[model samples]
Target: MASYQMLVKDVIKRADILLEVIDARFPDETRNNEVERDVARSKKPLIIVLNKCDLVSKEKLEETKSRLSKIAPTVFVSGKNRFGTTMLRHKILETAGIKGREILVGSLGYPNTGKSSVINGVAGKHKTGTSPISGYTKVLQLVNAGSRIMFIDTPGVIPFGENDEYIQGLLSVKDATSLKDPIGVAMKIIEKLCAENKTALESFYHITIGGQDSYDALILIGKQCNFLKKKGEVDDTRAAVRIINDWQKGLLVI
Candidate 1:
């Protein structure tokens, strides 16, 4: 992670404006506070970009934007669908307040937070490679974003000591098959869903989670999906992996 920190520092120093890309579903969880502090110390204009807005509701997006806008200029963008990319471009130029010269923009975010997709979205094409898998961007890339805007896309900066399995699972940094404790992560996901948007969870899995805890909910989903082992017991691991996969793929929102 030291190398990643160094890359972020280099980008902050070399670029004029910085974009902190975060998952719109879990803004606070995906944001790197330490990197934001570094950007603050540098006195560079930081834009808080809430990516994957398509997966979230408009009401929730407006609420999150209102809260995050107090810290910096915030923009809701769907990197996958290229939604609000024009607004993002305008925000970049408006924040930079520069003309007749190229503006170097630095992009930072956690793994799988759609940094590359945002770059490509703003560029109006596939300027950088992107994947759902984490750590896909291994090197710093400089792409011309047209209209005198240049972007410095760096690898996702996962803060040091951020090894929590649940957080990693939610961020898509570790996929369903990659997690060591898939069941535990899936339970956490269920708990969050139950608290935040139980209806969506029920609709997605076609299961009623009345008065059931996270584990029971997992078992219920397992039975609903017919993932059973011998003796008609629900396959906890398989069910957990399915939940994680769906959550990572944006099929299960909030």
Candidate 2:
């Protein structure tokens, strides 16, 4: 079990080509600047796989690609639907070209970016363990994508001292089970989602958010979900955790 830093270094060293997975909704936020520097130092062909593209609008996806292209070769992917696996595979083959028939493809991303699912799609199976929680994969686990490609799943590389409660919660890098202020972080998610599209959030959750602040809306959601404690008190923690999990799972959408 290598530490995250050492594990990331191993990923950079082993993989001939790297896929840096970022959430389609918050590509900029999910991206790790340190990982970018490490990839640059490794001099590997780095591809940016915007995971969960299905949740984002076509316009936003295009905008993201336009900006992200400046950072690396970008590809849109919906790991759940396996929507862009063919394109991903092709780009990888093209990038890793000619030197050898067999190529190792590894991924780097902050937590909950669906890196494992994306690579599983690349391999055409549910070969990797994927969860909404952070830090699932502990080390590089090699799986054969085919005769030509060895796919590697690396432990998610998150930065230290992520002071922003909202960022930490949304990215799911912080241990939600141990979070002292789940409702606070959940409010951040609510604020962001509401600011983006209150209608979408309302429609998805089947809860009217009209004139309600994020805190109040979350309590309402807890009620809607029938998550209550003794004396019929709405369980704020349950609702908040559910929201964060849904966001991570892409069920909440972009």
Measured by lDDT, the strongest candidate is 1
Model 1 TM-score, all chains together: 0.90
Clash numbers, per candidate = 0, 0
Q: What TM-score would each prediction reach against the true structure? A: 0.90, 0.77
**Candidate closest to the true structure, highest TM-score:** 1
Residues 1-254 of candidate 1: C-alpha lDDT, one tens digit per residue: 57777777878888899999998988988888889999999999999999999988788889999999999999999989999999999999999998889898989988788998999889975244322322233556777878888888776666525457788898888899988899999999999889778999999999888998999999999999999998999999999999999998889986
Candidate 2, 46-81: lDDT as tens digits: 999999888887878899899999988899999889
The C-alpha stretches of model 2 lying farther than 4 A from their native spots are 125-139, 159-168, 171-178, 205-213, 216-242, 245-249
Q: Rate the local accuracy (lDDT) of all candidates.
A: 0.87, 0.80
lDDT of 1: 0.87
